[model samples]
Target chain A: MRTMRLNMQNVCLTMVLSLIALGGCDRQATVSTTSVGAASGAPDAAPARKLRIGVSIPAADHGWTAGVNWWAKHASQLYPNVDWSIVSALNPEKQVADIEDLMVKGVDGLVILATESAPLTPVARKAHERGVFIVNVDRGFLEPVADIFIEGDNKAFGRKSAEFIVEKLGGKGSVAILEGIPCTVNTDRVEAAMAVFARHPEIKVLGRQPAMWNRQKALEVTENMLQQYPKIDCLWASDDDMALGAMQAVKEAGRDKEMFIFPGAGMKDVVKMVMDKDPLIPANITYPPSMIATGMHLCVSVLSGEREKIMQYMPRHLMIDVELITPENAKQYYFPDSIY
Target chain B: MRQASTRVLSLTAGGWAPAAALILVITLGFVFHGDRAYFNWNTHRDAMRQASVYGILACGMTAVILAGGIDLSVGSVLALVSVAFSMMSLHRQDSAAMTIPAALMIGAACGGVSGALIAFGRIQPFIVTLAMMVAARGLAKALCGGVKVSRYIQDADGRYIALPVPEAFSRIDARLLGGNIAVVTVIFLACVLVCHVALTRTTWGRRVYALGGNEEASRLSGVPTRMMKVSVYALSGACAAVAGICQAAQLQQGDPEDGAGYELSAIAMVVIGGTRLSGGRGGIGLTLIGVLIVGYIEKILSINNVPEYARLMFTGAIILAAVLLQRRWHPDSEGRG
Candidate 1:
């Protein structure tokens, strides 16, 4: 009878927590709706100051960009008073064109994820000159154009993955590298890993290949590397999805024993593999997709007149720390149900 | 008579050189890297087995090109069918007797839709199929709820059941023959045989060729040009669906994004196989060779430690070079002769 009473209490507590979570989501949604409606000029009757919000982002060719789109849309829903328009492009030139278009659209605020640094600086500066609120996410421009910058620490992600690999391999083994798309993120991570590798000359980098953040391509490339190299002790794939493909190739070749593959994105499957202490994939580094939420939160804070804390002069770069995910701590990162 | 013999000799030479080159390259790769444990028989066999999926798609593409129409929706159709098949299998909770047939039927249905649009709508095949490429992807994403769906069947005892393989087709995919030889290879070979017969022996095949050669003349001759176009597109779509299902089976997941950018590759393969993009004049045999060339090049590059971006650049260069070669080999150009 006592046990049953305790069980009821536990269930009730869970219900209350769930309700609170749901309530939070509801508030966010409501905020988004009103904000988006007001921005679009939907029947709000106070001599309206039309605040045009311009969103410049990368096209949804991959998962991270898709998440960015989702977050931007959600933010629009929350801030209905601001007129929001989004332009997504793949290349830097097109992104610059998009920014120029938004500038012409007379946007009051500009949120941009530049495809590159140098080419987009002038465009961002031009937008700033027009008195637009610049919120830069992930990739920053060459010059400081945005008042606030939000992004993950790619160098830290690389360092953590390298540390995990070194520990697992007992500080010595041949490691191959699979890089992401060529960019600041890719170069930073590679440099970070190389720094870690420098500490141990015994850990030779047998091969380094850019998988271009593609699974099939990575799979084929890894397969070929496996054929060429007699034994590869570790594979440090820069991203989780590419790592997954490399893992598949290793498995297909029946070389699971000799390989230890770890990628830096905290994708759910990799987290699961870490939790289970999967032989081939024993660790991963957290590069959360929820960084979009961080960007959205910053945008809200700035709009809500909490600008005293928000640096508005030069681009304020924010680097989120990367968490090492291993068997002991894998549960913290596991979301069996996350779309990412 | 002498001129006819010379022409036949040249045509054979044109076909056989690539074939001979392929054999020579594989032989060299084997001799240099060949050991019982290294570049073993299984390695080459596996490569060929995997290449068959693209080979099959190229075959269908070759046919559509011969009829002077392009179907860009084939890859999209494949994605749709794979998703539909996996979803159906998951819902049934069994890989029972009906699963394979159900998958095939779904593929056929998708093909039928694409065919109807091309044949009756009187739209440019490029435009119609381009719309299909997007719409089919949207449909697949919608059906699968924009997530990768894995199909795993558990037995009564709760152990996971082994993937279903038809008994008659098991030997073709045997590990000894190369664990990579998929049932898709057999299907592709059968498709090539049937298509060859239809193109060479059947009245419909001759009509297709005639229509492609001269559309207005064929129309004047009372050929059902519209029906043939529709049928060929439908056939292409079906082939894509088959490839998709096979791929999904191999991957053990129904990915909405599966076969992304595959249409471009298929088109490239067809064009490289010596098919004219302006419509008509190609065969499945050449497409097979094209698939082999592409598959071999990719395999060789990866083995050589080339970076992914460089590999893409290389593929693009090869494709451009092949197209240039085709232009140079244009029958009307007397310069080559």
Candidate 2:
């Protein structure tokens, strides 16, 4: 009987602690709402009921994802007529749970940048069935469950970057590739680049390694690659952060003069390097994380009763164009203040 | 078969196990030279440099494990300090002299909190450190606004200005000893030396082993077991801070998400060093061999350009093989940690 009483007390204590935690979250939400409210004029300033939109994206584990998160928050603050709740998750399970909670809150729309495509498809399909308008960004769901899908052309990102490398090497020098994590994006980009490399008979492809889209990992991998291959004329790091890291490794080896690096994703820092015409980084390709902001714009327009106006320019599947950022045109794509 | 295996383990018993494991792993390099990449001295130097951060963490981990505790918070503390150090060094333009001590203090405070919970609150080390791990990551993210703290700082006019890489950062990342050894590798060795002395020559160190061996007896013997627990964790935290500074220097940024899963590597290094996980028998010397063992295996695989999946499997297999080969069931293994 005494043990049972102690167990009951423990359970009660846990309940109180959880309640306090939840209360803290509530207060935080209220504070953000008021601040946003003040930023967009005053309370009840313009609308009868603000459309509630939920933004779910993976947590910023790297530079590109960090940019995605920043853009998502920035977009939320831009639209005054919509109440936005942004939740970033570290893994797919937490993302699924967060989406379910957003669904329970009866969000009018969801702007989802899924951590992974496979596991998020069913929950997204469920949300679609429940009449929540969906805007899927970057990573797509397995099923066509979203009202709109906005994605960057990762294949183009690889193709253009590879072509530039081939041209710069005069179609004969030995080149290498550094890949990101194994996912749809990585597969598409790497396979596309390999196809391009195969067409050029004179270009000797040294090898490729997955750096997992991390700077330190890329630096370490590049250090070993430099040692493994005595001469690499050109190198392609598929992401901007990896490019930065590989550049560091090359500099450390005192081999920066031997080859140039080509990287995708127009991170502001990388763009600046291009703008300054750094010998190591001659150019970059674009895979903008601002596609999240575009997704948010679509979500707001459709839910704000402007579906017809947006439909004139938007289709069910919107594939954004990927472009190269060279020294001559890098300034156009560079946003210095934005965090990537 | 059991008796034969037991005899083999006995032959590699005591500190000889980790050394044997190191030799065996190094022999793998001889078998597959990775197109002669393994023969290059620079490759070996880079391996040492790459392993330095994990080595530093393992140094502190040696202390915590010796005291019968685990700190999952080390990685998070590392991220926290990295972010803190980056913000001060890059955004605020603080000198290394100013930032290093502040970062170490932040890391120690984090570790001190977890220690207090475990010591005074009577919570499990795993649970307390786990909570601290989550809280520290959240704090790191909050502090940095979920972005990397890099050289790009926003001016008052909202224009992004590229600040020069701080002198302290470049110096830390630079090579020393005529480019033969990285400064970070030297720092890691210094940490190992400190932990070695603290574990081998000090009374507090003896009390830590006693606590891990049998907590109840240590407390009864007036060991001040609680204070020792707190101090060891703080030491581990300080080591993690040093690693964080190294990481930020190497990356040239303070990423809040850095060191996300490094605690496992630190733990693996300790365990592979023939340190029993139940806590009461290992030294910093074994950990050094473990560091080289793990480091060289990775360098060999990398120079070979082993595919990611194969690399993962090989790393797992090698770590397990090393630990199993070193597993001993000696009767006199109870007195030391």
Q: Which docking class does model 2 fall in?
A: incorrect
Error of 1 at A25 (Å): 57
What range of 10 consecutive residues in model 2 chain B has the weakest lDDT sum?
A: B2-11
lDDT per residue as tens, model 2, A219-273:
9999999999999999899899999899999999999999999988999999999
DockQ of each: 0.01, 0.01
Task: Give the per-residue lDDT digits (tens) of candidate 2, residues B1-337.
Answer: 3222322332244567567557756776665554344676666777788789999999999889978999999999999999999999988998888999999999888888888889999999999999999999999999998777876555787444567879988899788877778898999999988887777677877777777878998899798988888898898899889999988876667878789888989998887777767776667888898899888766655544332344556566556654444333333444324
Compared with the true structure, what per-residue lDDT tens digits does model 1 show for residues B1-337? 3223322332363455335435544543443331121254434544555666677677777778778788788777788877776676555444535666766666666656766777788777788888888998999999988765554334676444444433322332234333434465677778778876776667777776766667898889899888888777767877886787666555445667777777888888776666666654556666777777776654443332222455566567656655655544454522244
Instruction: In model 2, state the lDDT of residue A234.
Output: 90
What's the lDDT for all of these models?
Answer: 0.67, 0.80
Candidate 1 regions with alpha-carbon error over 4 angstroms: A1-340, B1-17, B20-38, B94-97, B152-180, B331-337
Q: Could you tell me the lDDT of residue A119 within candidate 2?
A: 48
